[model samples]
Target: MRRLYGHDAVDIEVATDTQRSRVADVLLTHPITQRRVAFEVQYAQLSVAEWRDRHESYVQQGIIDVWLWGHTRIRRARSEYALEPYRLDDVQDELRKAGMRVTFINPESSQLAIAVNRFGRTYSLASEREVDLVAFELESIRLSDQGVRSDAIDPFVTAAREREAALRERELEAQEHAEARAAIEAARAKKASARDLERARAAREQFASMPARVDARSGVVRPSVTMPARVLCRQCGKPLDATLAEFGVHLGPCRWEQERLL
Candidate 1:
């Protein structure tokens, strides 16, 4: 793996004391991007928590960590042997949570195998699929910005910058759309409030124009009504009573208008 990665301008077995005191089993550094990748070769039995802790520490230091399980052939069924670690499912679960894939290097064939799906426990052999190592290096380079040379920009850096710009533009556009929707909603609410106020004012005006009336037999006051007379009360054409100042210009009390105002 080191020899293959070397051709792609990646340095292996690099030492780092920032996260841990120990030397990494395999470290791949991109020359142009200065992206760092630490490959952990897990041969012995290690707990899932410990694995995650180490991986997280590397992540905090802005390093991409790849776990490489030792070549241990464990029988899953009668004839098939699962090429994974002791606690394959648990380790793979942790890897899946971190959005990473488990790697295995076949000692005999010197071939690389990657676990594509942890749930399905499926692996694809690199040699069989003709996976390009150079392409993989470029991908890793795009992940890290540490130690990147600013003197000259590579194709990968340009592409990464373009992707970031596009992502920012999309987020800005979404925010603008949300603000526009809120503004439209506010405008509609304002219009609705204005319409309600206009309706209420029109109802008050119509009620004020109506004339008061009274029952002849009971002598009780009745609701106002429209009438033809101009000088007298418009309701029943009745003359305004001087004693009933509360009735305004009408002959009877305007009880409904007073109740509505309250």
Candidate 2:
């Protein structure tokens, strides 16, 4: 096998004379270091039958990693022999349980699934998404003009994190909805988010009838509208511009004023 794969490791495939000898169909050894590897191949047609027949060959070698490969669909589908150290079906089953879209489809009767979120795109299983965000926020420092750490970095950061944690605890305790942000920019963010959400919902509602475009990444920014831009008209349907000319009061506007706000 080593001769075929052209690895620097040397492979020795041997049969055991004694019943106690651990058997490796292809025992790979690092040429110079003499590191030994006992590789086993089990087909979809034959797995434990093969392993049980070969297990006694490696017992004297102590611990040997078995690489199970080449199994048939009929052979790989059954879990009656599952609790074995290596099985393709176990990996495939767990991936299905995790609700991931990907599965093993190779012809070798091999299935290996490490879930999408578990694939280590970022942090470990213990600290997954936002671990970096939390770490960055925790380590945030405000440098002063004098090249010293500003007082804001200390008390302000600590207070903000404590406040956030407290909010999360309260939200969890109450079994409430998503916790809203409390940052100074939160009000503007909420307004922008609401506008975006409304736009998406409306677009989705009329998507089938909407015209197809070339290249497709185009949008328009809506002008800002706040309570200050509008005043209630007591009589007419026109939007009363907040014109405080006569006195400090916004009386209202007549119908011919053009813009309307009810």
Q: What is the lDDT of residue 67 in candidate 1?
A: 70
Mark the regions of model 2 whose C-alpha exceeds 4 Å error after superposition: 1-13, 16-22, 44-59, 71-87, 90-262
Model 2 alpha-carbon miss at residue 16, Å: 4.9
Candidate 1: where is the Cα deviation over 4 Å? 1-23, 27-37, 42-50, 59-64, 68-172, 217-262
Checking candidate 1 for backbone clashes, the offending pairs are 211-235, 225-235
As a TM-score, model 1 comes out at 0.44
Task: Give the Cα error of residue 124 in candidate 2, in Å.
Answer: 8.9
Backbone atom clashes (below 3 Å) for every candidate: 2, 12
Candidate 2, residue 236: lDDT: 44
Q: On a 0 to 100 scale, what is the lDDT of residue 58 in model 2?
A: 50
